[model samples]
Target: MSSAEKDKSPTKEVDTDELYQKTKDEIRPKLEYLRSVDDYCTSEAYEAISLIRETCKSLGRSKEKISKRVVDFMLEKGLAKLIVKILRSLVKRNDKSAYESRAKTHSVAKILQSNVKSREKKKVRIELVKCGIAYPLLQDLGACDPNTEDPRQRIRIITDLFSLRLLTEYDNPSVIPIYRSAKAVDILMKFAQVEYAIIQVRSLMLLATIVNEEESSRIVASGECILTFVEMLQKAIDSKDHHYLFDIKIDEENEKEFFMTGNRLTEGLNNLASNDANKSAIIQYGGVATLTSILRSQTSKGEKQEAIEALWKLSFVESNVEVILAHLNFDTAALEELKKMKSSDDSKLRDASTGLLHQLEMINIHDEPPEEKGSSDDQCHDPPPSYEETMSGMNVMISYNWDHQERAIQIRDKLKQKGFNVWMDVDKMRGNILKAMADGVEKADAILMCFSRKYKGSACCQAEANYAFKLRKPIIPVKVEQDYDADGWVGIVTGMDMYISAYSDAVMEKNWSQLFGELESIEKKD
Candidate 1:
């Protein structure tokens, strides 16, 4: 073999299992000493921590399976808590040596960022949250000089920000009180405005989760927050490179995170739109035009959905509704897309589009001259403006136990694709399940009774089925489980009807065609 070819050849792989088993006993004593010691300032503590840090480095990245075993051992011995305490103590000191010891910050961040299984990482993050890790990380963010030219310092700050993002990703309620106590909203808002893409994205993500109420939303709306999101979204629309909104050279590996910037920005706007004043602010910022632009462009379905939802929320404000109508009139293609979405396969998209169109139409009629009041063939119109008038077509609600949610979702998607409005608890139903189910039943033109042994036994499913029967809604019996015969209450309600089987994907095509035929029959009867 050539020398270069030899260099490219694979080397002997390390047996991480054997290595971990061999060295864990030796590593335990050092960890125990560090965990018991309160002050990491002493020489003995420094020596032991240095050894552990080196050991972590030797374990390689958390992407390797064996490294996690070592991390788990260290965590079991309380090293994770020790590292946080060290960080807390270090944050109070402005000494050079204290700054040097920030290596522990990197170590802990690495441990949390481990590419171990997702569930395991989630569990580890929740456990570390209890260790009071957030406060110290926030302190690090507050202390770091954002504009420093030093690469190490930038990396250190990025590590701190990433750790904070992971902790807040799940939006645990416990973090809110702690964040409120630390005035985290203000801290995060400051970083959200930074020019650095990584820091800004993480900060915006953190802010989106914590800014959950009217008071917080109003607070953000009063600042440049709304405009910031508007500007980012506008940049994405203008450049047509939906992946990178910011003017940064992103590596291939990091491109996915930056690609979500549009979604995150729209989500931030959605959260803030809960407050009425914020809705007005969004309109004034030209957010309506930009969101409409998203619909006009070839953006992802998720981004489009978020944009539509945001516009729908803003539509409630009278002035904002006028602005939306004016913009849509000028952008005829976007208006067409909005109208087409009324028949979108996504239930939420269809619902939002119908509602937004209804608002625009009602406001237009109120503002029109009497001579122009009579509806023209080209102008949009709806039945007399009422709550139910906002929704159209035959709304089908899928009644099934949670055990058969997958099957129900498949049916829901198929019906939606066939131009039927579908309401399933997993998507359309939110808030109180009982109340939502009742509303679902009352509004539904037909109910798909998905049956299985477990589904027949479920109280919630029983309630949904019985309620639909009482409302005299047309029931389409569907067998969600293979070879399952419905008996008891289910059999009585769906007596002797043709059963549409949705037991598996292989049979879905035939099942959907049959179900569509049934829906067609109902439509004709109505």
Candidate 2:
């Protein structure tokens, strides 16, 4: 054999391939036996992971053999179809409870190994193709949930796909289109708005991958995408939620995950802003001020670096320069912070500091800069606004179970045209689902709790209603379905009384007008 050929990794060697096949052949019967059982997240599956690992080790074959066997078993048992069902019902979560559950389930798939080697991951993806698992997996991503399924399922599916996409060349036309058809891009943006720090960060990691392209980046920036990052940066600065991962009762490892995610999202924004149109979108929506705030805040070094990088990227756009200069906290403390960084140990950071100073000098921005109002885009349509401020009348928070999202969105858009600030997940849900929900409920002057026949039992809906009650935010119920009856927990939140009905087309306008009246007249109680 040629020396060059011999230099190839074991993965490339045909002898290893034969060894893997032999190992698989030995385990195939046992795998079949395990697959017959109903679930794989139990003891039998954990045992299977160990068995496959041991068997591959005994044969002197690589771990890819084990991952391949696991994939083979899941496919052989037609588990992919079941996974699709899981994503469908996933939305109907237990949202009504006053206490938020902090439990996280262990990933049965990870038992294939905690962090599959890239080679093994590739092999597993290949074996999945060989076993015909990809088709069903892709099918699940594209299949529309029966509009009545829990909306949280989209969050679940997107989270699930992160690993699958990483395992293969998900960027390929065949696979990517399925995600696109599933509106995966939009799903991710909404995913970002969620409040759970881990999920929020995870969603941003996935979005960073998606927004690598010029067109995709522009699309994301033009929407609620950049605005979402601004919110995250603000939270990171205000709450420092990830800083004390121990102080917070979240997952141990997620502490690092949270910090890393912050950096990843900052980098994602940096990348998205590289495109001229997207940079404009970022600047137009007050992204510049938020990023500069990050630079000035007591955030972690990596996060601050990302903010610096984002500023550096934004500076490339000439139109964005004035806004950046205007919002830069050029007070002595801010300037001193920038100047001190010029002699940093990190070369990248030193360069970023020096460039920022040079730019400041060129612009003659020697004083504390003036505060800039809203994005250039919004100035054309409304009054001066903060980063969180939308075109406003009533700052409305619409809470509904996913089953009735179609109606919820219609109400949201209707309110928007009428100049009310509506916070509905359907339109612009991003970063940290639970946190977003909590923050929305807390900030809104009122909430429009949309319901349908299936809504009475919805944990998500009830949870929002309960949260609003906790905060003393008045909930105005707008029923889109004719048959939904308010009872049990629903009655507790909305009162055992009548609500607005949109049953007939003739009363739609009058019903909405009345809802608006409630929005305008209801005084917010502290």
Candidate 3:
């Protein structure tokens, strides 16, 4: 053939017809034996299953269709129940077959992790779930003994850890809740507490994915896991050479691990700290110092910014601010790092760092001890008018998420047209938002609580609404997002309060008038 002709030749595709015939011939006998035997030898089961696993894995690397067809055939032969049953027995055995057992567990995890068609993967996962695969895999994970002297055992442990982590990364919604039910969360948390950095990182990644608000709140209430997460950050900061916590080499894949681990650790801490009661727990558990260490470490920009954000959220609490200041006194570099980042070329980092500093400054100003009344100059510097006196006649404060800002403004205009005094942050207050929000809520007679998913997610809105609730201001819940029911903290804060629907133009036209009437009723009752 000519060189040009050779170069132009299409790449050879795998012969699906031949591959299918060969794959069935290879696994059908083993599948038949496993299905027929009610009591099978461990070694025999491992041998048969591992061979099928390897054959399918090899095919999957080249073509998903061929591997998927093979998996379908195995499922048709009831491989899911057979594998789970065998896995349960093997994981319970403490003999020499332990390594093989973990290897089998790893095989199933790999199967689930395969890049098959999504529908096929979902089918496989559902079948595994029905067969109770999570219990044995979690059992193996909980029982994993990282034998330092034996490299094979260690490799098996790492394989199991990676496999379990992959299950967490899978998109199937059925997996996590089932895993959670099988006590997978507590087991994963136990795994994270192990001394191995790789184990800890993998476990933490799974926890960050599956932990709900209630679970996180429980973690904070117990005050156990919060410090462990904070210490992971401290480890990263203290390591002279990077990758000390994760122990990964400086490759593209390992670098990603470093980045992801950092993000997940910070994210976990951030989520835990979002709960108001947890704020003091975190501060007491040395979270402030560990977070500050992250700011000073050679972590990724995103990770450092997240640390700043967590700190920013913690700063909302007055007592927590005191703890942060105490930490800042000794670790001056953390404050300097934050100050330097205020001018960062990265917009998000700059804004976050700047916002954190602004919050600290506001806290300091509010917490300052007042001067004595003896001096005339001090008398002349008397405190400014109270919110009630200065912003008199404001009827309601419209607190809404920025995503629904247009809706908020529309509501504000309508109120104003009816000669009702309303307060909404249309100017988009940047750094000094907390104080502005306090002022708005403090001045108004009622707070218009705009309920949406984004509204519930916003830390600023939470702070605003909580402050309003704290001051005993009447909160009028306004439904802004259709089909969204308030839950978690939002649900508790707005508990049993009547919600007025204004989710769409039609709904608003019908129900928006109810808001004005409610405000009038509140005013008259006051």
Q: Report lDDT (CA) for all predictions.
A: 0.66, 0.52, 0.68
Q: Highest TM-score among the candidates is held by which one?
A: 1
- Per-residue lDDT of model 1, residues 1-526, tens digit only: 9999999999997687777776687778877887676776667776777777767666554345666687688678886687778888887675556666665554645555454455556656666778888888888778777665554555566677667766655434355567667777777767676666556656665665555344445445445656666776677666646644332323444322224456656665664554444667778778888888888788776777778777776765567877888899999999999877755555456545655665566322223222232332223322321112223378787888776787788887767666788777763342223445666788888888988755653444655787788789999998876644665456777884568887888877776778888988997899
TM-score to native of every candidate shown = 0.53, 0.41, 0.53
**CA deviation > 4 Å runs, candidate 3:** 1-95, 104-136, 142-176, 185-228, 245-264, 275-278, 326-333, 336-351, 361-492, 496-526
Tens digits of lDDT, candidate 3, 1-526: 9999999999887699798888899888987877776443467876777776776566546466776787788788887887777777777666666566556646755764565565577677677777777778788767766424344444555566666555544344456667777787787766555655555555655665556555546445555555666666566566664333433343445322223355656765775565565677778788888888887788788888878888878887767777787777678887788877765655457556756776667333233333334322223332322332222265678889877888888887887777777778775553324555666777788888988755764566776787788899998888887745666567777783568888888888898668878887888888
Q: For model 2, how does the per-residue alpha-carbon lDDT over 1-526 read when each residue is reduced to its tens digit? A: 8889987747554565565566557666655654465444445544654465455334323455554554555445543333333323332343322011100111323233234444444444444344433443444434424222343443334435544444334222233334445556665555455545444445555544443233344355435655655666555556645331212322445321214345545665664554444666677777776677666676566776666666765665457667777776453455566666654545456545655554445422223232233322222222222223556545778888675676677787888777777767753332223345666787788888776534543333444576688788888877765544554456556785857776445666668878777776784333
Residue 193 displacement in candidate 1 (angstroms): 8.0
Clashes of each: 0, 17, 0
Q: By TM-score, is 2 or 3 better?
A: 3
Q: RMSD per prediction, one decimal? A: 15.5, 19.1, 11.9
Q: Which order, best to worst by TM-score?
A: 1, 3, 2
> Weakest 10 consecutive residues, lDDT, candidate 3?
376-385
Q: Best candidate, lDDT-wise?
A: 3
